[model samples]
Target: MKWYFVLACYLLAPAIAFCNSYGMGLTNLNLAPTYGKIALFVFSSLVGSDGGVIAGLAACGIIMSIVCSAADLMQDFKSSYLTLSSPRSLFVFQMICVAIGCIIAPLALWLFWTAFDIGDPDGEYKAPFAVIFREMAIIGIEGFAALPKHCLEICCVFFLAALIVSLLKDATPSHVSSFIPIPMAMAVPFYIGAYFGVDMFMGTLILFAWQKMNRREADGYAVAAASGLICGDRVWSIPAAVLSILRVDPPICMNFRPTSASV
Candidate 1:
């Protein structure tokens, strides 16, 4: 399985590099889904039910990586074009970062799992994304009709609301539209916990204030600052997990739940 994963990564690297060179976007690419289906069939045939599940997961991961890399590479290409930077340099740097991530991500996950119970109902980290993925996989295998009627109805409501909001955003003047909440932003809290949405709202409020105070410097620094915040949050999790494993908690309590006594 490890060898197959490595082989797939090796094969994908050149394909991604070729696509990036041609400035081709993956938005309309039908190749990934086809490849995924083929992989699913092959793995299922080679192993059994277990292999089929593994293959499905592997295929999903591969497809996601390809799509994400395509988007990131396209953005990098556009940025390079605007700045008159070397595409070669950008590609090299991207590959270096990718290699570093490949090494670091598994290590971080291992540390996290070792330090604390993941997917625990009463644990701080419930692994919501994992639950979402598992449910999605079950739906994929059982067919959309197998999903609960209430869930389907909720989805329809969100979809219709999003459509209306999208139309309004298109029709409204830019200044007015900018103030309107995105349908996705409004809907996400229903699926994910409210704390995640709170972080997003805080970030949005900070950016809004920054732009209102000085539009010029905001344009230059807002993206960099936000990117740093996002990356720092993830990077800090590694050390925090390490501290947890070492039985050394931070001086300040980062997690605070409201208790009846406090109330």
Candidate 2:
């Protein structure tokens, strides 16, 4: 990891990340982020403490963006393919979006950065993840000795479980395997809560019901309908975030609670 080589990597990282990350999905497992993590940890280990912390932070951010972009692009491509869109056209569209994102993302970040003390531990927001990620880099440099009690063991156990599940899925027949829950997908609920899982289950039920009632119509427009609903819900968050940043509360508030506090 020479300075010159690292510089070259920065120049070619997007292309390299896209290929390795997306190509990995086609080959077997789609652990795009893991590749980025390995690069971060290994690079951190090779550098001194100050350099490791600073460079590792930069590397972690870049790796995350690149790997995440690749995975997201893969999903977009899948949606396009399902909708009978051309790969060439999708690729061109993606490039254009990437160009726009390159400009917009930085400006949005700059706006937020100016508004909030992002890395400050004592700031209003107190970005705890900054400390966590930095600590991860230090651990990379310090080796397993720096890990919390049972952290290494837990990680190893989960890694093996994911591997075995992936193996079983691949070995099983397609009919049977489709029913097999993806380890990565299953892992999401453990950390993020089962609200999303419930949503997926309900969506699946609706789709199945729709197909049973009218298979042809469901096949034709189900994705578009689902995509529109999801996009609409997500798109509202953009303005909601902007309003919050500007310290403007919404005019209306609604909440459903199981119990209300007595006045």
Candidate 3:
């Protein structure tokens, strides 16, 4: 079973490489879904629904773990390179951290699971990315029928647009091309939700203002500031989860969303 998966991954290496390369992926995690979708499509064609769905899901899970770890370790490796730290020592620490995570993660997940309805349609903690991935798997099984009307055509249009954008970027100078949005960047919000777009817009707006005011400080502190904001946001979730488990609900919680539509 393990070797079958290994062989599957080995077979799909070219697709992975192509996606990573042509998609302009800066990190592994974001590109995992693309490869997963590819795997799902290929396997569904090669084998029947029963085997293929399981294989596709298994591949997706493996890919997720692989990419997540790769992205995490790559950041650490780059930081180590900058600081002149021992790679062996860093690897040892990473292994230790992984061991700790293996023990701690389940407990943390249990706490959250108790606190919130994770995948509920009307729940506060809807797992949108999971929904998207599940939809991809369903589409793999049901073919074009699972998708919204003209969804495939829309995707084709975007695909051509992306290709054209890529070519124009190559043809144009750096200054001109920098203004153009990459397809992958655009796809992030599409895969996740509109929230990411809003988040990015705010970040970009702040950075733009900062740059106009003080380019040097903006350039120096932009990444650090963004990192701090992101870290704080995630860290706050722990306390929020704890409060939820304690049966304390925030009085002022509000939700503003569009009418329910499967996008």
The estimated TM-scores of all candidates read 0.49, 0.60, 0.62
Encode model 2's per-residue lDDT on 84-187: one tens digit a residue: 88888888888899899999999998998999988777778778877777777787887556658998799899989989998999999999999887776666
RMSD of each: 10.5, 7.6, 7.7
Q: What C-alpha lDDT values do all the predictions have?
A: 0.65, 0.73, 0.71
Ranking by lDDT: 2, 3, 1
Q: What would you estimate as the lDDT of candidate 1?
A: 0.65
Number of backbone clashes in candidate 3 = 0
Tell me the number of clashing residue pairs for each predicted model.
0, 0, 0
TM-score of 2: 0.60
- Writing each residue's lDDT as its tens digit, candidate 1 over 1-263 gives 34675476557645654543333332212234333443444333343444445654565566556655665777787679768999999999999988998999899989999999999978999988667655445444543454577876886887798889979998999999987776644654654568667867898899999999999999888867977888888898899899989999668776576685552
Which segments of candidate 3 are over 4 A away from where they belong?
1-8, 14-34, 58-73, 81-139, 242-263
Candidate 1 weakest ten by summed lDDT: 21-30
Cα deviation in Å at residue 251, candidate 1? 8.6
Tell me, by lDDT, which candidate is best: 2
| Colliding pairs, model 1 | none
Model 3: how far is 4 from its true place, Å? 9.7
Model 1 stretches astray by more than 4 angstroms: 1-66, 77-139, 184-195, 247-263
Per-residue CA lDDT of candidate 3, range 51-106, in tens? Answer: 65666666676665555554566667767865789989998999999889888988
